[model samples]
Target: MELISSDKRNQLFERFAHDAFHLELRDDYSVPNEVGPFEDWLNGRESDDSFMAPWLQLMKRVTESGKTVRRVRVVTEPHSPYIQWEHATTNVNEEAGELIRWLPRHKLPAGLHFPVDGNDWWLFDDKLLAVGHFDDGGRVLGSEIIDAPEIVAECIRVRDLLWSIATPTNEYQL
Candidate 1:
């Protein structure tokens, strides 16, 4: 397996933010120290509309493309307020209900998957894989933490199984 650098991983996320599909596994999305990059991306839209406009357009396109974007978050303790704010402010929860769906630990989508290990998050596209590890400070201790091919394959498999058992959030509400 190829080892991707932290800078490269950021670029990958930016790429994903633009066009590629994304999958994230975390305890919650709102850790201020942990979500710095994502927060930067979100805040950029407010300051430099031009910078995030294209990505926003791409997000709309992806949502309309009928391609499934999956995120599996292992909820533990109190949920992240930042994540809640993000979901609420961007209306990602409603939009995600419509476009993205949750996968249970026992099942997963056809081509995507990941385990719910604490702080171990993986982002997958057709060929590339990005992994990140955060310390208690919410600072990224390292993103190039996992490089073993077998580990990647295993994570993908685990994600698939979970997706199969997962339920869409909207379905449970009503």
Candidate 2:
């Protein structure tokens, strides 16, 4: 297994955002301040009322431009109303809800996909495969970057299966 440093993983994401399909799955959408930089970025904005404005704007542009940005949230402990509130305040929940409403969950066929247990993220771009590991502090430790076809195929399969079972943001009747 080849190991990739954190910096490399960030670069990969930067490039992947522009070049490849992206999917992210998290155990819970909400995280503590010390766990990720997203909350800090949101709180550090110049205006309190416009918190998450930039994120919302970007999401709007992405959706308007006709691109797919799929995300899955696995319900677990430590659920935070703050996170949901933020999404609602920014209109992100509404936007995501609308997008999901158009897509029938039953149309998603069974297949393999990646599994996100919170600390690791597996990515597949064509024939390349990367498995990133993070420290308890939420810093990427290293990644096993491989070009093996079998490994990439397996990761793809895992990703598909997970996607199939994920609850659609809009179609979630419960």
TM-score of each: 0.52, 0.49
Which candidate gets the maximum TM-score versus the true structure? 1
lDDT by residue for model 1 over 1-174, one digit each (tens)?
244555566455444432233345554544434345456555654322343344455445555655444554433234455544333334443443223344333333465534435345554553345666666765555555354667666766665655556555555221
TM-score of model number 1: 0.52
- Cα RMSD for candidate 1? 7.3
- In the order shown, what is each candidate's alpha-carbon RMSD? 7.3, 7.0
**Candidate 2, position 30, lDDT:** 39
lDDT of 2 by residue, 9-93 (tens): 5455434442223344333333343233455445663324344454455555655555444444433234344433333343353
Residue ranges of candidate 1 with Cα displaced over 4 Å: 1-7, 13-25, 31-58, 61-68, 77-90, 93-99, 102-118, 145-147, 172-174
Poorest stretch of ten by lDDT in candidate 1: 97-106
